[model samples]
Target: MTKKRALGFGYLPQESKHHFLLVTPRSPNEDVAVYERFDWDESENQETGIVEDNLRVTLDRHKWNSIKDFLTTSFNNRLKENDVTVGRFKIGHVPIERLLGKEMVLLMWAIEDSDPQLISTAIKNWSGLSREERWWLFTMANAITGHADDKRGWRKAIRFALTENPIDDEDKSQVNMFEMFYKNVK
Candidate 1:
């Protein structure tokens, strides 16, 4: 009894309930009604998109919800709610939709101890590590996130660490986010 709303790679059954979605891989934007006659199942949704293709990001429903909230609260960024355009917002010159799905997988490995809580934990995990370590994380993350142009892998992670507003205060120092996290990490 839920209304399907187009959400890029899939259809979010109801905007009010952002838990899970029914994906239409073959025809992304059409009203495919993938779950029309059948009972809705999360595994089925995953099979149609994530498992088979390895092109989409697949996480437990609960984890996915947490990821959304974490992205909004911690980074003040979103995973591009509207998936109509392939890469609505660019992350290191790569489309967010395409890059994020895989980057998330890499992020998981980076913070294996943490489920990428996406707040202080993720920042701590990244900042606490050495530049060489961060570089390793970046290279690995980029490999999964579909290598960016001009070897901008580092920029992808840095961009992921970006905030909504850089110039929030009078002082320019306050705008640089990596230093802020680096200070907090130490």
Candidate 2:
């Protein structure tokens, strides 16, 4: 059996049981931030000696909307404060039915380090992707966010989402939610 390589970006999470990386604006002068999103892969994290003093916020089932509002406002307000006319990070918790305009999409977009052509081409051609590829991406998103309740399981899920193909026989319809969402994103 081959070892599964977790992919996507990984950052250190906060010490609390529920933590998420806060994507903070760099300064009051710019909308283009020096920081985008934090990476969250916990397995290699421990191996690299990053198990402590790291944090991101996590919300219970109830706090999703509120936190989403806060993050969106934070991203928006910082831009306004800096007098930026474009480039907004209106990120928030997305309802399963709504499609894009959620943290998932924002995170994918905020990958400032990925190949620009890759990102742009991928996004542009999103609707053109095969059903299986779209399903894999959505399943990856679900796997990243909706996995086991513990930190380890959470980390593992994060790794899997980043590194592997999420396609499987389970939840094909749910996966299509992402497909519909991505097609409507632009």
Candidate 3:
């Protein structure tokens, strides 16, 4: 008869005559027992929590490169599309979260593309706009590049852009004239 140990959830595999098996108990009440002439301790048993943590860390480190590549390819494809262009400016000012829907995408791409350095240079050149402007620009670039989807958010942003500078009397007259001309054309 093979010697068996209580595994909490079930019985541990029985020990054989020639070899000893090390088994971990599943619950607090279950006690681990050696099947043959071998020493075992509860501390040596792998804790589920520790194993999960190690797995998460390993996945995060190893998978980051693959994720970056996928995002870069996808973003490049979107940026290359013709319909989304707005006079050489593909991306417009919009919230990052609204466009990308995931902050991690932006963070990963920014890190991989050395966007921080580029951003720093842009900030230096456009010193008038604050950090918010730089961050917004980064987000807008990602959104425009198709790394993120921000159509709804873009509409709202457009409204804000148009309203930012009040229409001057001269511009208003030009707009009215254009409207009348378009109406006549119609």
> In lDDT terms, which candidate is top?
1
Model 1 agreement with the true structure over 100-160: per-residue lDDT tens digits: 3333434433332233444344444433444455445545654555222222354444535
Q: lDDT tens digits, residues 1-186, model 3? A: 332222221112232112222232444344222122122234554322132211100112223433434434443343334222111101111111122213223333333323233332322232333336435754564355422123335323432332232233432311234665798998
Q: What's the true lDDT of residue 25 in model 3?
A: 40
Preferred candidate (TM-score higher): 2 or 3: 2
Comparing candidate 2 with candidate 3, which one achieves the higher lDDT?
A: 2
Ranking by TM-score: 1, 2, 3
lDDT (10s digit) by residue, model 2, range 1-186: 332221111111332222233333334333221112224344543224222333222332222322334445543443344443223232321111111223333333222223333333333333234445544554454455432232344344433333232333343221344775788996
* TM-score for each candidate, following the candidate numbering: 0.29, 0.24, 0.17
Which of the numbered candidates is closest to the native, going by highest TM-score?
A: 1
lDDT per model, in order? 0.34, 0.32, 0.30
Q: Against the true structure, candidate 3 has what lDDT? A: 0.30
Better of 1 and 3 by TM-score: 1
Residue 185, model 2: lDDT of 95
